[model samples]
Target: MSLIPKSHPRAKSLLIREKLVLGFEQGLVAREGLLAHGRGEAFDYLLGEKTNKAAKQAIKAAAAQILLAKLPIISINGNIAALCPKEIINLAKISGAKVEVNLFYANEKRKKNIIKILKKNGANEILGINPNFSTTLSGLDSARRIVDKNGIFAADVVIVPLEDGDRTMALRKAGKIVITFDLNPLSRTSQTANITIIDNVIRAVELLSITCKKLSKNNKNTLEKIVKNFNNKKNLSDNIIEIRNNLTRRSRFA
Candidate 1:
């Protein structure tokens, strides 16, 4: 009955569930975090991962906006690589968006390792400097964290999946369009984002691919139409209300 010990047979299962939930708030993901644990248990019980209808709609809008972009880029972090590397690469190829490796580790060696993993998986054209170099974000994913008026700043739109908070907030302040994935509807990363998908990373990525394929023949006006209709704040607020109402109803029933 002791919950404090990892030696318990169910400890690993419980730990994974907890981490998956925690990953949303902390922006630091570890195997033992709550988000990891929750996702594992969700899959175990929900028959292994799925995306809902609302999420698919969001993905369609995302795909259209991305396809219409002249130069779209995806910011890849360690968590994304671990969960959905292949899907990320496929999406990049389809959307014609470049991939950039970004992480929270502010160390040079860590940067090299992360880039190596990305390159081996077929990513080309890495940008390490933003022309406004500072010692602040140096260890925050290696290769120098510089935010100039160029680099990431030059991008019209950026898709940053499984991202960190500080950089995301900073990016928005600098006037960049940011789209991100955060499962928890209440998390800052989700709320702060221009477009947020409240679904598991794997499910979101796969659905994103499907939407991209559908939008392949779409013209600019059509793509813009999709973008014009997707209300990021509205979707997020709706999702939060739905989740909360369901929880309240379940409590009453119990």
Candidate 2:
């Protein structure tokens, strides 16, 4: 990682870029993943590079959904493995969600690298590796359709950060509650997910973990109320409005 000073205005963003770059070099992130991160970064700029109120609402709802789920699974890809492996593990631990490596650019070596990192970061059991347990999810042609029978296939809720659109739709079609962290509120992944946190994955994961811990003490009825009260469409619309407000505010300075 690069030694970026905290005083730098773009330090955090620069550090994230460095992590992805290093991940690409270390075979933990694909070149395509770098491109995806760049795209998300552009939206982050529109979002003022910070978590907004809409995102916080989504996070709270997502935590409630995860807690209410009988079987929750957190899906991991190479970019996620490289960027926030410890956060992933912590979220899984707090939410009692199973950790699984499910990548769009699926490959054995990359899977091994991701699993190794997760294990190194205190992950005990990760699913979505063995071919014997692999099952194809209906309605998707991407490599992401292949999921472990015990993992995503059977999960009641799935937390898929940095996810693809088709898989998000497919997971929804499969009757699983899907949560995602996407910088772009307008993306299909954001629209398709049951709860979309329009915040950077690194920050969103930690927030979700913390929210899960805080919500864990609540009764099932309370948790269900939180989930039921949330409306994804309304939240996404609010995020769009927020972006417009941000742009308008910045235009004054310009």
- Cα deviation at 67, candidate 2, in Å, is 0.4
lDDT of 2 by residue, 116-172 (tens): 889999999989988899999999898988999999999999999999999999999
Query: Cα deviation in Å at residue 169, candidate 1?
Result: 2.5
lDDT of 1 by residue, 51-72 (tens): 6556677788888878877667
Q: In candidate 2, residue 220 scores what lDDT?
A: 96
**TM-score per model over all chains:** 0.73, 0.98
What TM-score does candidate 1 get on C-alpha atoms? 0.73
Point to the candidate with the largest TM-score. 2
Error in Å for residue 80 of model 2: 0.4
**All candidates' lDDT scores?**
0.65, 0.93
Evaluated at residue 156, the lDDT of candidate 2 is: 94
Each model's backbone clash number: 23, 0
C-alpha RMSD between model 1 and the true structure: 6.9
